[model samples]
Target: MALRFEELDFQPTPMGEISLRRRYDPAARQDVYEVRLGDEYLMSSLFTAAERALATLALDVLDAGPDTGPDAGLRVLVGGLGLGYTAHAALADPRVAALDVVEYSAPVLDWHRRELLPDTAGLATDPRCRLVQDDFFRRMGAAPQDRYDAILLDIDHTPDHVLHPSHAAFYTADGLRNAAEHLTPDGVFALWSDDPPEPVFEATLDEVFAERASHPVRFGNPITGGESANTVYVARGRAAR
Candidate 1:
């Protein structure tokens, strides 16, 4: 067998230089697609369990109970379009009526539009999904009241580790309050953190939402052959104090 390698696209964005590449991994015995921001590995197709969980875990909380029908026509806002795992996972649920994905990188969106990442390209054509080019944090602040049933984020590395300094505000008490405005009463807000659960961030969530939970999703690391975990912070939106 021969090795496969390709640099699908590369461009300079407001954030920095971004590149998309496709390579075949012998250990994983599969083709993998990756997106990078300069020297940082933004996302990979090989390890997507946590990204997918970000959607499922949040939506599950909104799932209908015995007395209620399915939470049909659910509207969701996904903060990142990395490889489309989260959006795809959200659309997997029959109840999801719409998924609005806000991505700050136009090149990233172009990659999906051109099908550079085949597995994730389906998102572009999915009737339930909409790809918007904009700053997620800004859009969240400008969003109308009760505009979304759930808001799923995977933009930054973590609440404390942000790619851009401006993003730090989103994790603060006031920043989170702006984001909460977009959520329906009882709406769900879930964020994907590359690191484990942090007490400080959890405390911030408690301050912003009436109810919240921190979920540690563990998955087998193909390269390490051991379990690695990511934190998914889920909070229920409530009227501002």
Candidate 2:
């Protein structure tokens, strides 16, 4: 049994004030974990279908590719820590050899290191997963020499709707092209969006990737008593500029 409601941690960050909370949900009959940035609820354990999909869908493409073999080990870069759904999902696939999670908020990394949330408890200790405190967008812009087999992003709400103005550039053609430089030749890039598929953004993918797609992931919304959906954009084979 869990308490009715409890705030586990709170901290003021450069982005905004963030808090971690846990509450007992009568409908699910279990404890629900939530992360809130300012007044905005960033994520909740009550719904995680899309977050998990962001990893699975991206890796599935790799599984189907010609590179997949018993000796093929994948290196993945995850841009966002959130509730650890995406990280945990990436780890679930044995093909993943290394995972680097970049999060701007130090407090979020601290929470995962502290093991305050069950979903992320082992994230900090996992040998394969590295918790990095850095701006994901900045790293992408730098175009570090290191490359990854797959890059999964779940930071922004959407291309149109971003938490910070700095992240806005990432959705554009040039920014996406920069991100594509960090991927292996056949590597994949996957992003999670809260909105439905946007054709305009899909065109941006065309400018950067040879093969790209946007997948709509629908899940049950208990609060609305109906279905809600999110989009997962996947791209691979960087296009010649």
| Model 1 regions more than 4 Å off | 64-72, 143-146
lDDT of 2: 0.90
Q: Which pairs of residues collide in candidate 2? A: none
Per-residue lDDT over 75-155 for candidate 2, one digit per residue giving the tens place of the 0 to 100 score:
899999988999999999987888999999999899889898886579999999999999999999995767888999999
lDDT of 1 by residue, 49-145 (tens): 9999999999999954223455457889999998999998999988788789999999988877887777766888888789999899887667574
Query: lDDT, candidate 1, residue 9?
Result: 90
**TM-score for candidate 1, residues paired by index:** 0.93
- lDDT for 16 in candidate 1 is 87
lDDT (0 to 1) per candidate: 0.87, 0.90
Distance from true position, residue 5, model 1, in Å?
2.0
Candidate 2 accuracy as TM-score: 0.94
Error of 1 at 197 (Å): 0.4
